[model samples]
Target: MKPNIYVVPRWSGTIHSDWYDWLAEQVEARWQVPLRRLEMPHWQTPRVEEALAFLSEQVPGLDEGTFFIGHSVGCQSILRFLHQKLTPESTSPNVGGLLFVAGWLEVDEPWDTVEPWLDRGTLDLRSVRERVLHKRVLISDNDPFTSDFARNKYLWETRLGADVTLYSGQRHFNQKTAPEVLSALREMVEPAN
Candidate 1:
């Protein structure tokens, strides 16, 4: 079977730029895989559960060993959602590897991103790390909200046992600047060991 990769962008991003249809239209010509995206708008609602629910619906349809590309706040939501689903008894057959782009492992209350994260409470962080053994945290070396990139990387690596990558001169890893994110997602779609 061909690969099925899900591109989950943050609350602030959109389908056109981050997961541009043009790229999909182009890449599909060669890969023949279904490269698609789902919108997670709970950040505007300021509720993490709503976004998690949206993601949960898709989890069932995804094939085993599916690739999940989560960006910014979507990364946090996916982790929390995964932890909720895969406790001890419950298991999702779809999950394979997690590729978190510009992932926000640390909970911050930025004026825009604060209220929604606060709604989920601090406890969710522990839940996510406890379950998300396979995770990658991509940090921007010059993120505006973060004071120190190394500090954030350390926080995620220590808390979630995440493999952190700090990309220089990038801010938030948004579509405007991070055009290479498409290639990054493609790489993660490789069969996981």
Candidate 2:
């Protein structure tokens, strides 16, 4: 069966915004992949637990054929979910891959909304790494919300063992379309030998 693709939106983000809709269309048309853009609850004032619960309920079958594309805080939600759900004794299957856009370990602004996430500490990379088959992070060189590019890139690389890509000026990546993201998704699903 084709892999199930889930797109987790950013804080205060909508499934209708950015390149989400375009990605869904392209994935279905090109690869026959089923991509579902999840609408996170309480997006304006997001809580980690809430987001995790929502994802658990939404995506109950996180098997080897499952893939995730997360934006900003939604990236955190996906990582945290993996960290929380996967265990050596658990019957849950390992996930296929993860593609995080504008993902971050730390942020420059919006302390009020981001403080809870920052306070949650780092993810259990050992377990998460073992469970996830592929991991990639897409970042912007000039993102206002995430200024410390080097640090963010370092964490995603060293901790999660993810391939980090730095784009020139895709600030926050809230654009109408993202061909780079689509290309990355294609690579993840159809990796080059």
Using lDDT as the measure, the top candidate is: 2
Please, what is the TM-score per model?
0.77, 0.94
Runs off by more than 4 Å, candidate 2: 119-121
Candidate 1 stretches greater than 4 Å from native: 19-30, 61-64, 107-109, 118-134, 176-180, 191-193
Q: Evaluate all candidate structures by whole-model CA lDDT and list the values in order.
A: 0.63, 0.86
* Shift in Å, residue 133, candidate 2: 0.7
Candidate whose TM-score is highest:
2
Residue 65, candidate 1: alpha-carbon lDDT: 52
